[model samples]
Target: MEDPARLAALETLRAVRQRDAYANLVLPQMLRDRRITGRDAALATKLTYGSARAQGLLDAVIEACSDRPLSEVDGSALDALRLGTYQLLRTRIPSHAAVASTVDLVRAELGSGIAGFVNAVLRRVAEQDEAAWVDELAPDPDTDPVGNLAFTHAHPRWIAQAFAEALGSRGEPLKLALEADDARPAVHLVARPGEVSADELAAIVGGDVAPYSPYGVHLETGAGDPGDLEPVRERLANVQDEGSQLCALALTRASLEGTDDRWLDLCAGPGGKAALLAALVGLEGGELIAVEKAPHRAELVRKLTSGLPVTVEVTDGRETGFVEGAFDRVLVDAPCTGLGALRRRPEARWRRQPADVGQLTTLQRELLTEALRLVRPGGVVAYVVCSPHLSETVGVVADVARRTGAEQLDTRTLFPEVPDLGDGPHVQLWPHLHGTDAMFCAVLRRPV
Candidate 1:
């Protein structure tokens, strides 16, 4: 029989590629179903995530080594070859062990004929080190720096260009940003106020308080599952990125002049920010309305805010139809391409395409417009996206501000503790700079 860990990884990869499934969601359930735990689970997790993250580079190397085009290769055989090549190029698993184990896996799954082909391709792939293979296969950096960085770092070329464009005049931040995305992100937990403090959550999870967000606790990437923790089960804390927590908190901290008793979270789903916002709103004797278009996600939002002063509604946020001046504060944590969160979801970079941006920006603009309409005059509408793409971040905000004549508030002042924020009325956080997802936040207000 093949190594159980390798078998698990191969199954997870097939699920991701064939079914369009998410690795982060599929892998954990797989581990549970297979009764994998401890070190074996860790190995399987690494194999699955690393192979998914490096799919672009591994396919390039596989094509260089294979006799036929990768498309012509059998589906099962191609997945087996990707597993073997990822091990050969990336992991410290010794040559003889990696090769022998993978050949066994292929033979067990695809029979001897395909196993022979996989063995031959992987042997050729194993002949060179990773850097040498990259140098041979990657585009020339001097002539095509973006393509070079994309191939070398295992990102789509368009995404690399988007990051560079978002950085603007900042010197070569793209490479650093790509490298940060390549690294696995540590899990972050937010201890909801009036429920559990960050310090208390840290003690329970054996984690440290996050530097930027007062509510955040940083845990090691594979420190078991966050759902299994007691705090999470009790809803005292939930899995959240530090940057996301900061974005939600920034909205709460933005100085508004008049009544602040009512708040709206347009497009709130799977309810992380809404949970935090609900807690904060409750503390001030206020109520929060969380609207989501999908019923399943709206159910999740309801579950997350079960005991809080929050009402979850299943309605399209772009057409929420609330009174024009109903809310004192509004948050449009808009639907986005999720480019900022590539590290946490390893397969996302490979799956996303440039065409996705235009559709997402359109929805984002509609949602922001609705959010602005719902807020009272002089009240704040915090526009946030888990993306740093220029079009999605500033372009959406600028166009909306211009069309509505909303005043853009300087967001840097809201988070006075954060450093190196650049010249911004809007705030863009980076994984390399902020140790958080590339969340973008801009606070806009209707004229009184």
Candidate 2:
């Protein structure tokens, strides 16, 4: 019989390959359909996400092993090869078992001829472990250090270049950043204010309190679906990155002169920040107006913030007709290329092209500009993105501030005791430095 776990992983890859479906989104339902749970589910999760994350490295190795070029290989056979190759190189699965399972899966699906082809490729691939393969196949470190590190860490060359550019260093700092960005981050949960403190929630959920945000808790890595946690299902907490929690909290920390109640989350979607903002604002009897362009995501905002004092508006944040100088605090958590949170969304690294930056940065600038216009004088706006790409972070903030004459605030002050922040009027938190998503935040205040 075909292993259900391997079959599930294969189908997940197939969905991703054929439909451009997100692995994270597709795999969960796939698991449910097959009633895969316990260790089998965990293995399936690991293989599916790990294979997708290491696609660059795995494909290079597979092509090296196969006699034919990858473009000529049947797509389904390639998926099986990737799964087998990931197990052989990255996981502890024994080489024979990895090869045998993959061969069996292929024979069941594509018959003997293609199965024989997959078997040959994967067996050749198993001849070298990951480090040996890296030495043989990776770029020459002496001549192309960044490219070499990118290959070792399974990141695309352009992404490594961007990180090298962002860090202002191409040596150890860049390597550490890429290493952390490549690993899976722990699941972080935000304790709903008034409902649970981070300490109380941490104890209940068997997690540790996060170092940065008081509302944040960290579950062990590979804790399975955080939605299955009782606190989350009971509405006492929500899954959010610690970096995101800090950025949203920073908006409230900015010194506002009068009326600190009215707030806005200008690009709130799938509402992680919006829910936290709404809970905090509602404490002081304030209300929040969350704007999302997409109707479906706006509906998600409403569901997540159901009882909170939040109004979900389906409108463009660049022109939310809520009147200018109205809100006391605004969060422009702008849409980005999601370069920062790559570990969480394994497929994103391969899918995002550098060309995506120009379009996203344009939207980011327009959103920040609109946020500045909407905040009352002396009111603060937190311009945020899940990416540390310079164009989306400093470039967007500096350009918008220069044009609007908005005063830039030292964002480090808002993050409080967090260290290794670099010289900053803006803050770029790195995964290596901060153990959080590589979230970037810049605070700007309108002139009174």
Candidate 3:
């Protein structure tokens, strides 16, 4: 029989390449449908994500070996080459098996002609290890330090530049940040606030409690589908990154006086933060309004927050048409370039462009502005984005603050005991530093 893992990985790559499907989203369903459990499932994940993560590096090697440009290569053949090359260079899988299996699969699907081509390219790829290939392809560090390191770490140069700029340095800090991008992040789970304690949830799932978030758990990487976990299945806990939990918790942590009943999640969809916020507000008998413009995602929010006191509204957040200054606390978890969470979404670094930033930043600014308008005077609004890009993080917050005269609180203080959160008023969490997605949060309060 054909190797199920490699076949699954190849198909997943094809889906990602052709349809812009998320590997993380597509792979799990494929594994389930194929009944690829345990070692097979793990291998499929490693192959799929590893190949996606190292696309740039592998493409460089393939183009070096190929007589034709990658654009000229058949998509299916290209997928097989990537799978074979990732195994040959990165994984411990032997070169003979990697090449033979990939060629065999290609042969079965596309005949001996394409298989011969895949075999030829991959055999050339196996001639040198990843390090040797990187050394040959990477730019000289003396003149292009960032580009050199970015290539070495298998990241797009623009992403590395964004990381350096966000850190306010292009030195060791940039190197550490880029290195963090290459590590596979463990799945993080958020224990339902009123339903399960973090300790109990950790014990139930055999995972470690997250260091920072009181209700967060870190499951072992490749520990199978977290969606199948009992707490998750039972709705006692749900998958959410610790950094995201901290950002949601920050809205609750920020001191509020007088009425604290009404809260709004201006852009809540797929509802990770909304669920947590709902659970917290439910503890206080308060209600949460989760406004999601996409109907399908809004339904997701409704489903996730079923028992919690959350009302999902399908409308553009910039014009929710709700009463102005009606909410006591608000969360503008605005969508952006998604540069911060690249470690979790391996293909994202390749997909996002610097040009995508301007459009996203404009939307982010509008969302924050709307959040400020919806928040009552003296209420706090946590402006959160799963991006460390300055234009999407502090730029939007600062610009909106200037325009609306919203008070920028020291956001660092809100995330108590979370170390290495640099200079105040805004928090940028790094994967290497925080072992969390590089989530950015800025706390703003409408002036009384």
Candidate 4:
């Protein structure tokens, strides 16, 4: 029989590659189906995520080791090779054990012929330490810094360029940001206002208080499924990034001169920000309208904001049809490339392409335009995205401000506690800097 943990990881990788499934979503279900539990489950999770996150680098290494070009390798055989290479280079497993066990797994899944090929390639792979292989295979950092950083850090070159561009002057800061994208992100829980305090939730869950977000707690890895926690199960707190919590809080914290009661979450699907916003509005004796275009996601929004002063609407944010100047606050947490949260969604870097940006920025502009329309004069519109790509962050904000004649408020003042915020009427949070997702926010107000 195949080693269950390794087998589970291989199967999860296959699902991600073949079916376009999300590793984080597919791995848990695969483990449960296979009855993989305890230390074995943890091992499976690590192997799966580590292998998926390092696919680009692993493939480069495999191409170097294989007799034939990577294109000639069969899909199943390629996945097995990737799995074995990841274990050899990334894990502490001895080369002999990593090779022998991977050979066994390949034989069980893909037959002796492919197993022989997998064994030969992986043996060559095991001969080099990870850094040695990286040095041998990675593009020169001096001439091709973007490509070098991409391979070394397991991101696409475009993504590395995006981060570097966002960082401006580079060296350590750019390197640190790229490295952080590859690291596993800690789970962050938001203690919903009027439901639970961050301290109470942290105590209950044995997590530390998040450094920046008043309502957030950071859980240690392998803290088990957060859904099982009573606070989360009861809707008192839910999984949310500290950056997202801060973005929602910033909207409410920004000083405004008008009646601040009605709120609109323009793209509130999968509802994390909407739930946080709803809880805040509820405390102020206000109501929130959460608009999600997809029916399924709208249902999710409904469940997430249940018992809060929020109404979930299934309508396109670009055409929400809300009365002009009706909302005291509008949140355009627009659909973005999700470049910011790579650690949480390990497979996304490989999935998204540069072309995705053009379409998304178009949608982002539309959503921001609609948000501007909904906010009354003197009311605030928080344009937020889980990305720091200048096009998606500042570009969208700048375009909307120019077109709509909205005043860009200095967003830095709202998060006075956060350090190294850079020059910002718009706030850009980084995973390396703030231990949070690279969420971007710009506060704007229409002329009264």
TM-score for each predicted model, relative to the true structure: 0.98, 0.99, 0.99, 0.98
Question: Which residue segments of model 4 deviate by more than 4 Å?
Answer: none
lDDT of 1 by residue, 85-190 (tens): 8899888999877888888988987899999999999999999989999999999988898899888889988888888888772236888889899887899999
What tens-digit string does per-residue lDDT give for candidate 4 at 1-448?
A: 5588988898899999899999999988887788888888888888889998999999999999999999999988888888899989999988999899888988887899999999999989988999999899999989987788888999998998999989994477888998998988899999998878999999999999999899999999876667768999989999999999999888998888858889999999999999999888898899999999999999999999999999988999999778999999999899999999999998899999999999999999999998889899889999999998999999998998999999999999988689989988899999999999999999998888
Report the alpha-carbon TM-score of model 2 versus the true structure.
Answer: 0.99
Query: In order, what is each prediction's RMSD in angstroms?
Result: 1.1, 0.8, 0.9, 1.1
- Between prediction 1 and prediction 2, the one with superior TM-score is 2
Candidate 2 residues lying further than 4 Å off, grouped into runs, are none
lDDT of 2 at 40: 88
Task: Give lDDT per model, in order.
Answer: 0.91, 0.93, 0.92, 0.90
Regions of model 1 farther than 4 Å from truth: 169-171
lDDT of 3 at 392: 86
Ordered by lDDT, highest first, the candidates read 2, 3, 1, 4
Angstrom error of the Cα, residue 134, model 4: value is: 1.1
